[model samples]
Target: MPDPARLFQSLSDPVRLRLLRLLVREELHVQELVAITGLSQPRVSKHLGLLRKQGWVDQRKEGTRSWYRARSGDDAPGGTALLPTVLTLAEELPQTDGDDERLVLALGARQAQAKAFFSAMADRWETIRLRYAQPEFDLGLMGGLAQPEARVLDVGTGGGALLPEFAATGARVLAVDLSLPMLVRARKRCRGQAAGEVDFCCGAAEALPLGDGACDVVQCAMVLHHVARPARVVAELARVLRPDGRLAVTSFCAHHQEWMRSELAHQWLGFERTEMERFFRLAHVTPGRWLQRGPRSPDGSGNGNGPNAADWPEVFLMTGIKDADHGG
Candidate 1:
């Protein structure tokens, strides 16, 4: 923690207070922060630097872009004691009429970029998956499916890639996604023998359209990094899961692949295993087994032998089980 004098000095600025409020609501890049706060980029960055130094904010750097967010309560030095005072003071201050509206616009732009990318690439995902990851990632995550007679949900089931696998388990299947074009492709792809047994819904992961304790298993493959708020998604997944329900997530481990954001409309480059574990713990779920593969050989002979093996990062499947006493 910084000295008390310095701490209060940092908090004295309205710009910093506004920035703290904005970042607490969302993790935003420098550009987005500038847009939302209606502040010059340098002014925003200057205050963020001070907030970060005081452990009041966290910054994630990727290539040339940096994402900033208020440090989570658990990570803040005096958050449990000081946050209430800080927030109370903030609430008593002048309200910025346009900040919330601007924030929504910023986030909507991010979502739209992803939707557009998926809409155009819905059909090519099958071929695209082969380019970045091996079968091990998908196959390992599939192990989390529930037995027949149990219900299973595939959250953000892009192109319904795993619909057939879910159906073959003989469990009732539901596929949910944000992209309609992707859902259409998934429906068409799963129309074989057990296709009639599967269901589909177009929805967002952050706010799933499902009842409490809805299913025995939830599989979210390659989906977390695409969403703006993955922790919220995790909580939503837990909200709809039954007691002891399993949650399986397949995603790329943290890496410096900047191309993914532009080429794949990825909101995040990837995620750290520890980061994912924290997400599960916060949602009151027990972290389970983890399976991983990748960083293929230069000769294209490793786990995911694709051309330019050095370009791909590690991929992993992380699973968790809802505690019997976990809240719905």
Candidate 2:
């Protein structure tokens, strides 16, 4: 059991309490904390250090920045007992309109930075990505999960990186994306190799063009967060996959990157493991292997674990199979 007196003492500072309130909603880096709270770095670090020592917060180092989130449940001492009360108290406190305004500015700055990077590198996207360490997952595994001549649907198949992989498996591929320019690039990339094996379609993930039970394997890579309704897209993916077919999705894990929305056109920041599991259950897809990887460098040159690792998004790869008895 934690000392109740010490816990109360920790929450006595208004600054610490405010920090806890922000952290409870989203994981934030020290710079974000400073920006949100209008506090000096020294003061913010001091308060965070105390919260961490008391086991009221957890920290993770990403590159040069340290990210902090409120700890709850089994991860926190005394579980949720004191923390929930503190959070509630923090919420009940007077609101600071300036904090909200500053937050908007901070997020806007991040969005501008991302937008500029993407705009400048759009033509050399693939070459620029090679500068960072690529995600270390065997895409070849998709071939084994697919049957020969299987109808494979690749939703949001940006430049068709995986189209050729599926094509090489002898699966007839349908690569779909909302962007006609991206679809054009994808078609060109897979030109001679995927010649007759692949078909490019301009379509949205939430409303795939194909009929129900049309595909044996449905693969979506890093696209769900961009959709307006991720759950609907999941349902659509499940609907299009035939019984006993597989659905493989790769996406970012939950994070505090709101800039993604304005800059990269992401709808949701990311997803939680529980949310993904719920989607699988709702879709009647039996969840299978799950894997998570930390941020990779944007240049694809260094291991993501290094200090120089680019603040790339943390990603996960999840798969599920449609139940044999499931009716689309």
Candidate 3:
């Protein structure tokens, strides 16, 4: 193993410094480092090699590419403090924040009673197993992310589908869910993984029992629409993200899916792009993108190349920076 002290020294180079900063938020490969730090591939590789020798980082192979991440344990080359310090410093930069509300109240009651409902619906979970496990929505939400060796947090993780793919990227994954049964299922799904590679915690999204700003990317997919108080969930998601960290939340836009409308058995609001903007404003989170299928045509037919009905009701995939002003 490389010495942590020496590893810290190797990370002192400017390009290495920027690379480490970016990786502290999300794992990136050499090409990504090259793109972000404006360094040549050889220089990036050299720094990474030196850093690896010092035990500051670790790499795992996926297909033809290798992704690097901060290693855990005392042997970690970055030493105990280096990566944390770099992450803290990065958080001082400008950040963003995001929210929604009253249907939330009703959702809370349903969530509280989720055990019974989901238990009865467990069989159905298997039907949607592929859907939940490999949600196409995640492709859009995680589009810009997916770093090698990243540590990702999946909040309100149902059926634990997102966990495996994140793990497949060789990133450490932590999944939290409010429903006990859901957590049980998630744990079962990740059984026998390498230690620290995957973890499941039972907790509500509003009161996560995690260290502040610990995850590089915190994602909540398809869960916000089910929360009784989604604004509070937004605040919590923002709270757990490091200032430079990314939060991508995927939920139903107020209108799109006929199934979701029927599932909720209400005239559930689909987001007007503007209304969605307001939701983010309430939580002090700046919206990054409004990913949608092409605009809908008259008579509700989506414009060609727009997202289909199955991709909906429309998915409100939004990303934001964690506001530093609202300290967790």
The prediction achieving the highest lDDT against the true structure is: 1
Clashes of 3: 19
Q: Return the top candidate by TM-score.
A: 1
State the TM-score for model 2: 0.59
Q: Is candidate 1 or candidate 2 better by TM-score?
A: 1
Global lDDT of each candidate: 0.81, 0.74, 0.61
Q: Summarize candidate 2's per-residue lDDT along 145-262 as a digit string, tens digits.
A: 6566889899978777777767877889999977766777788889787633899887778779988899989988887776645666899999999999999888888766544554
RMSD of 2: 7.9
Model 3: which ten-residue window has the lowest total lDDT?
Answer: 95-104
lDDT of 3 by residue, 256-321 (tens): 344543343222334466755655666666778766542222244444233333343445677776
lDDT of 1 by residue, 110-188 (tens): 7788788888988788777766555665666556565777788899888777778768767898899889999999999
User: What would you estimate as the lDDT of candidate 2?
Assistant: 0.74
TM-score result, candidate 1: 0.92
Q: Name the candidate, 1 or 3, with the larger TM-score value.
A: 1
